[model samples]
Target: MLIIPAEKSLDWKNPPWMTLALMLACLVIFVFYQGKDPRLLHTAVQHYLDQGLDRLEAPIYETYLEREIRLEGEADRRTDLEAFRETVAAGERASLAVTMLMDRPFFDYLLANRDLLMNGRQRQYWTEARVPIQQNLINEISAYEAGLVPAEPSLYTLVSYQFLHGGWGHLIGNLVFLFLLGFTVEKALGPGRYLLAYLMCGVFSALIYTGFSWGSKIPLVGASGSISGLMGMYVAFFGMRRIRFFYFLGVYFNYFRAPALAILPVWIGKELYDYWAAGSTGIAYMAHAGGLVAGAGLILLLGKGWFQAREAFHEPEQEEQDRQFTHDYADAMEALARMDFTLARKRFEALWRDYPDRPVVLEHLYQLAKLRPDLAEYRQRTRELLNQYLKLQQPDNLLRTWQEYLELGEAIHPLEAEEHNRVLFAALRQDDLKVAEKAFARVRDTGHRELVREAGRLLADEFGKRRMEPKANEYRLLLKTL
Candidate 1:
């Protein structure tokens, strides 16, 4: 199952540099630093393995002696104990075959030292005991040196760990989410606070993971924990706003529009379920949960008013454009109110040219077109307004605007025939004969057979009832031709 937030909760005038930089940094670290050297890692693993094995030798020997002394009382067990002792004395490193001969106590001891022995053997095999390892040791060195090991938590690893990822998929997945959620948080919190919050959440995530997986030697890496925090911030910031989301479950996919806060429980529940069902599947769900909690808590403490205040700082260019749009819109409205067609037309034209997407500009322009005596410009502006409304993809606005367009007696394009037919059908159902008649006339020659037949039938029935014989007969003949 996959769920992605569709609409950006907040819009930014300029590029979100903090979000972009974070993503780029992750990519660069993965591609350049982490992917550079395999041998160095192998060597480092070998080195640690050898060191660990040396530390375990005394414990292994002590356990062996204890087991030998215990087995000496039994004649049959004496032979096994002697054989085990010989194998150990032969300086042969622990192998699966040798470990199999061990009793419960000895086997447990062997298991305790398994990591060191296995790593040592793997390193030795890969390195062939060769001297002068290559210069590319960054990847190997970074894992333990920079990456967070839950058993050995440190201040530096808390931040550095977020940047390290296990593979390409890990890196890409985290980066994608980071960008999706981070930019919104940045837009709300401002760059400085956003960066600080991100790092703190990451640190908290690491701390949470460490608490859960205490003494675990495996290195915890990736930005998921921090991004989870951003998700939390998102929920806190725009939780009440209805946000659209695209969801997929295997072959089935659909969209849902719900309050942004609704996603929080879903995310948290999924993480909790996965964490329990799939024990330690390399994902630090706890860290994600922790980050989410931290982010949400931080936002709550800062209060909603803080976010509103931060939003006041917009890019200068966007602010200037907004100011200009307001000034021009007001001027145009004033001119229209004064019935100064020349000045009003000029201002409306400039507004439309500058802000084509502004629905209000189209509405005013359409109004201006109606007041002026220029039939050609009136028709042109009416078409433009209709087209803009269609492009907006707002169903309610489209219906309202289309009704106005029909009332104005302007032509609609063939491309809009299907939608126009729907509006016509709605108008007819509502018993608005005038609008229905106007819409039918516009779509009559568009070659929409079913729509034309339906319109002809409706128009004929209505006209026949009104005792309009000529109009009724014309519609009947039109239907027969179809």
Candidate 2:
């Protein structure tokens, strides 16, 4: 009869790894866009080469980089690199054209370079490009503010900010965390809501960061803002549940389960510590704080009692266990009435331990339990019964017997089987088969012999659809036994 609170009932079975994967993907793109420096470009080409992208698109990306270097400034020059850059950038649609041209001969290269271009080099590129990036974000926001699009914060920076990062360590750390947390949260919330939440959190965090650190000229990057949002919601919804983490150091590994709620205090403390230690050491702590709050609030709103009430109320499994006990008791009586000793013995044996105080019923049930074919402990039940009956004495035992019989027959008091069966028989005579079947089954299930026979006959005749041989034989057999 215990009821669990609706807010506490969240499906926290799986970790939010999907959200993390999404964050990684976003990280790669962010790195590429933000980390476009000569060293980064060289590293990207090397990575593409390592990944077997050289044959597909490495040459093309190299060519494009060379052209940019030539137009901007050249740090390194080697062999066919210059021609390759010119050829690729000369196309009508440089980006798509470069992609198409490279795909045929250097597909792997494109993928390899994709991580480099998207994630950025320590995001070493240039903060100047971020102006356009932020400007584009502001433009998108303006559209919404001007009523051209929905008032969605996600559109402002969620997509773009995922690619931004503080430095190599900052980028890698944020991305790794994002990949781990994003996937799971996304799956739990579902794609659309997860995507919306992620982007909104990112946008909100970015705005907060910009407001406090205005014109500081730091190329604010990293998925921490969005990923922090996921962590916040996770802790809010799953609270005290243990979350497993695998800590890694060079060639060593260890695991531990920490309460989900602990993440918030630790995270907040770290941000505060960092903000004080180095006032904005390539991390947007304000953004992370804002994102965490937003995520927790959103999940709470969604998990509210009213929202839960809109869905069907699902009681905890204990209710099912109770119903199972009741059902087994009912089934035991039905089996005993049909002389299905095998099933009855099993059910009564089960009930003996579960409801031992009902000794009047247990006397018969104890006898039935003793008849269990595979019972190795029947002797113990018999001794218990003898001891119980000894306590009842003559007068009390006789009174208990009459009380049990009255309960079994319903001839008096709680209106037993006598009148109920008559009513059932009358209904059967009038061909009100449904009523007859219900009443007869109800009485027969309690070892009411006459009622069982009547119900079986009516069921065979009226409901069995002209009685197939198997059914007729079964009914006849049951009737004969009764």
Best by TM-score: 1
Each model's total of backbone clashes: 0, 48
Where in model 2 is the C-alpha error above 4 Å? 1-24, 27-35, 39-159, 166-169, 240-259, 305-482
On lDDT, the candidate that comes out on top is: 1
Tens-digit per-residue lDDT, 113-187, candidate 2: 555554454223322332232233322321112211111333444456555554577767776666556654654
lDDT of 1 by residue, 1-482 (tens): 77766555445556789999999998898778776545565554355346443334434555565555576442334555566567667755443222332122343444465555447764464344211221233224556567898877989999998898888888878887887777767877878888988998899988988998786656788898999988887777765778778899999999999898778778888878878776536688889888888887777777555434264433334556799889888999899889897898899888888787688887877777776423667666655765675566454555576766555644422325666676666676666777778778667757778888887898899889989999899899988888
Every model: Cα RMSD to truth: 17.8, 16.6
Q: Candidate 2 clash total?
A: 48
The lowest-lDDT stretch of 10 consecutive residues in candidate 2 is: 142-151
TM-score of each: 0.50, 0.37
- lDDT of the structure predicted as candidate 1: 0.70
For model 1 the TM-score comes to 0.50
What is the lDDT of every predicted structure here?
0.70, 0.54
Model 1 / residue 196 / CA error / Å: 1.3
